[model samples]
Target: MKRGLLFPTTLLLLLLLGTIHAQPTPDPLDGGDYAQVYARAQAGGDAVTASRAAAAMTEYRAGGRDWTARAVQAARQATTTRPGDPDAQLALGSALGLQARAGGYTLGALNTAQQARAALDRALSLAPDRPDIQAVLAEWHAGAWAKAGIFSGGNQDRARTLATAAARRAPDTLFVQAHAGIALSLIHDSQARATLTRAATLNADTPLERDLQTQAKRVLEGLKP
Candidate 1:
């Protein structure tokens, strides 16, 4: 896809920030104020729920204010409870990235920007062999580059590289392929169209996978000639 055919930065921000909102039917897991429950799950010392919820929160890239804060809290708690788990780190990094994007130019955005990068760097280091981690990190880099540019540690080339690597590693995984396509399309990679097409054809086994497919299809539409 040509750079000129891409949407302007403002529009790109809206989409990448997940404001497009043209989602499919509400899934059981995504509906309601589940974020609150997820946030409070760890408060009673339920480390298992905290870990699972943190991973769940990382699935959806964006959300409303209170929901996002709660999700971030859940992820943070997960990290505190399971510091050795790469999933916990991925959750923290990915959620912080969303918080930063939603923060716009706020002072806290700067804080989250740094924390997000550090958290994701740690995640990849902890589990370099995991394609799921690679895909999530790919989206983080793409979004960081789009929102904060190179100064904030967002490298388009790195995003593309990780996305491609993830696709190669987990070609059958729904989120992996979808995120790979999303990251590639964000950087205007030539293979984005094919990757997204592959994602669109995948059988989404979970609500989150269905949601990811929706994002993939949306980006595929945008990338079409």
Candidate 2:
């Protein structure tokens, strides 16, 4: 079977990546704005850059494209400044993937998608034992496959394997369980329901994690029938 990359699996991926061109969400932090958030993420420490860049993804999930690409560039600069920083790599990969999805299916978007995959892969390479990276990579592979199938180098089985491991290793981590839920569902795994339920029960500390939990709950609800 063409396990890894299939068109049918892309829908959940798009759901997680969020839509582009919608009205930007007001900054979640009480008195903050997109420009200020972007600036803070850019000028912050690499770890802060990664974390805030991730919050920017929540904006994408809310359908705002305004800051996603710029956040990605800031996250990318973190990777360049600290080539071995796994967190930086993950943030860059994720932002690029979201930014590409926001761009639609143009040629440039395709190339950006490829870059996202490369960064995600690099993150895994840098931290093979990290459940967080594994969880993200699992969804990335599945999403990539959905975008271009084997041409996109996505592997559902690979996604399943990584997600299973991530779920087992980091059961309480919202990002891990939520992303694993997505990876599992894309592959039509029976565990999707359980994983998403687990994710739904977890506490969310950031807007990103909150959106992730909301996504997991929606996916779980869809599976109830």
Candidate 3:
């Protein structure tokens, strides 16, 4: 009887250990990594990046429910965590702008873009000769100008100017080239093709760089006669 009881107890312990080991680890987002949260959200499906990016871009106007809210929260956290980091501020601004745009409020989108512009401006002020900062700022300005809706004050001339400046400042940067392509495409100029081609030739590894390159290609393709 004692031997039988010992065997059963040992079996139960072995089963419990197996169960514990078999349990799958939770995603990083669930464990409090916001960057991983964004990554997981992006990896969700079909390059969605998040439900908002997938849904809101539809032709029939899909509503952005909590997507904007989450984006805002993430942005705030990033900005707060590193007050002196321009990259953090840029991420915050980008998140806010994306959320606002997807939410479909022109004023809100413009405001968010402006906030991003301000952060970029501050970054430039702090490090005037920083190539990366200049490159990003140029992209932001060009994108802001190009994407301005009819209700917003979008000046094509200004957009072109900014894009040109960005290209000049960071001629080798993929994002700057992409932004220049977008701006030129908006103006229906032949230069867009060259810019887009140049952007594609560069190695874009980061999500942000990939996004810019993809956008540039799309814009360039759309402009083809």
lDDT string, candidate 3, 1-225, tens digits = 999899999999999999999997642322323344455666553122342232223211232535555555554554566567665555555555555455454676677667766766766676666655555555555555556544344455655665666677777888578756766676665667887788877887555556556777777777757
RMSD of each: 17.4, 17.3, 12.5
Query: Model 3 — which ten-residue stretch has the worst lDDT?
Result: 51-60
Candidate 1 wrong stretches, greater than 4 Å: 1-63
**Could you tell me every candidate's TM-score relative to the true structure?**
0.75, 0.76, 0.57
lDDT accuracy of residue 122 in candidate 3: 68
lDDT of each: 0.76, 0.76, 0.58
- Cα-based lDDT at residue 205, candidate 3: 58
lDDT of 2 by residue, 1-225 (tens): 565566557876776567553556643342334345555655665443544444454543452665575667667678878889887888888888787777776888888888988998999999999998898889888887767778777898899999999999999888799889988887778999999999999987666567667888888888844
Error of 3 at 72 (Å): 3.1
Scanning candidate 2 in windows of ten residues, the lowest lDDT window is: 26-35
**Relative to the unseen true structure, what is the C-alpha lDDT of residue 114 in candidate 2, on a scale of 0 to 100?**
84
